[model samples]
Target: MMMAVGVAERTGLLETAVKATIARAPARLLPYVVAFVACQGHVMSDIAILVIPPLAALAFKAAGRNPVAGLVGAFACVCAGYSAGFTVGALDALYAGITEKVAAALPMGQEAPTHLLVNYFFTASASVVLALIGGFLTARVLEPRLPEPTGDGSSGDEESPTTEISKEQRRGLLLSAAAVGVYTAVVLVVWLLPGSPLRGEGGALIPSPVLSGIVPLLFGAFVIAGVVYGVAARTVTHKNDVPKMMGESITSMSGYIVLILVIAQFIAVFNWSNVGTLLAVKCAALLESAGLTGFLALVLFVLVVTLLNMLISSGSALWSLMAPVFVPTFMLIGMSPALTLAAFRIADSATQMITPLNPYLFLSLALMRRYEPGAQLGTLMSRLAIYVVPFLVAWLAVLGIFYAFDLPLGPGAGIEMP
Candidate 1:
């Protein structure tokens, strides 16, 4: 996925898509459009953080608004709405694997959900709602409070004169889209045919080979689209370019690879010592005694995670440490591991702007400094604080609605244990 996304980015396919959306948006709707685009950035992973802000600033400047506000608002949406997206991402797969492992250790009667789409229904809906909230805040609250961009909006750095999509880029995007569309059609045909090999026993689609093999499917789709785009855009002049790009992508993930190794050891020890089960049993008993076993228990968990997220900015590290304990504790109370994971995502994402530990917050500040040289860290945090209350409140309300109706979190995954 990284290799493909990198190739698409290098070929300008991603930037063209973003620019096309912004270029067509009306002045009054720019905030919402930018916000939606930022939320969609999760599909491209961290690249969106670096790509969206400056482009958004340019869009705001074109629309006669404060470019700095545009940059800040887009950055906030990308970070705070990180977990919410229409399409499942690598993070979803990562957390699902962890949830499956922790739940498996607990002897939960029902099967634990390891599917990437386990939280799809909730997070996908949240993506749209959060985008709307981001848009409103950017237009009504954020822009008015932020100072106007000074000194010709250049930020003392080399700025692109325009965001116009080049002819080569447009052609590459067209070819990429076509390639992905064809690839998807072929996959669907193969999977949906009568007596398809992708199906499980009795032709069950949920636990089928197609669903379980989604990672490879996604990888193939992205690689196909990216390579097509790169070739058309003249970015991949030789066949070896694709392999080179893949190697570079893997190289960039060295730090995360090391972190995962440590996390694996920690989880192994956590399971072997039986401390996780003991802590879970005691915590479950306490929650049950306090009459906080359901909605209220989940609410408290969200709050705790929100607070912890401010202190520990790495989502993967935090989830790795917490999942062993919380997954089982919630399961003991008859809640599904998926639900526990969903609550964690809400708290983890919503407080990102206020977390000083978030390395990306510093990246955002540097980007803002390009437009506002006098912008202080305190000022940025204060302005960002405006987003915390509304985002948290609105997101919790979303969870409440989902809980009240007992909606399925994803395919064959519910709000409670079977």
Candidate 2:
């Protein structure tokens, strides 16, 4: 995540492209463009919130539209899309690693080898669902409700500069795209070729090197793409600039890294004490006794995670705490580990928009106040709740349908355990 963002920032790939796209979009489509930008939070919520909202505000202003609802709507989309991205990235790696580690501690843990793409299908689909819903609400519901902007069109910040895509930037973007294409081809060849190294023994795809080594693959692809873009874009004039950007990115993430370490230790302690497993067993037994062993229990579990998300804003941190208990519990009751993760992701993401503790929420408020000088936190929260309520209800329905139909959460990852 840090690596990709650092490169994007240095090369101006994300911001410049987004501004250019929005600039070209029809006035009536501006809201949907903002929604699309916000849905990109699936890639990096922290980055999306910081970069997209301000640009969206600028777009709204240029289109002679009120920025209030659009800005808030973009924030809402980012929060909702945080759990699902178009492609697998660091968050997928982190969550899957945690799930695997926790699952390994269970009695039947060895039967369920965690794969990087465990929730890929569901999450990728979820990205579309969120984008569509957010765009619809922004266009049909929220925007209509917002009052006209009264003050000067300034967003309290200095006006955004005209962001014309430079020839060099275009070349850089194209070259970066080429690099990614080549890298993806190589990966596919390595995985799809019979007797390839990435394939498991006897060429099995599951439990293969591709799944287990996906994190490094992700890192390599992003770093390679970033470097190519940076050099082409002149962001990296010297070789040392690469390491400097990486260092700065990592340094900026010191707080999050520290949090992950603390949470990792807590997970370790919990697992060592056998508390999570025992609790899972008891919970599963209790649910079974109450005739809530399947879809109903899954729905209840999601609601519990949603409540937990209000207090704990970090998805990975919360998953570290919850997966150990919930994954095993779900698996014990005939649900798959992948299905449990899918439900947790839906709940965690849907509630992010409403969580006061979410750092992004405060950041979003600050951004909103830039447009509406009088924007109060409480008022914004109340307005945002309008979006959150429907988003949650719709998402829960999606989850329910997914559960009831016994959908595949990902490739070879069905809702039922063996």
How does each model score on TM-score? 0.95, 0.92
lDDT of 2 by residue, 346-365 (tens): 78888788788987788778
Candidate 2 is scored at a TM of 0.92
* Global lDDT of model 1: 0.83
For residues 1-418, what per-residue lDDT tens digits would candidate 1 score against the true structure? 5665565656566777888887778989999999888887877778788888888988888888888878888988888888887765567777887788788877672476657788888888888888899999989998987776654656455655356877787788889899999999999898888799987779887778876777788888878878888888888889888888888877887887898899888888888999988999999999999999989998899999999998988888899988989999999999888889889988988898878888878878877877788888997898888888888877788878888899988777888887
Residue 144's C-alpha lDDT in candidate 1? Answer: 87
Write down the worst ten-residue block by lDDT for model 1. 153-162
Please list the residue runs of candidate 2 whose C-alpha ends up more than 4 Å from where it truly belongs after superposition: 152-163
Q: What TM-score should be assigned to candidate 1?
A: 0.95
Residue 386 lDDT (model 1): 82
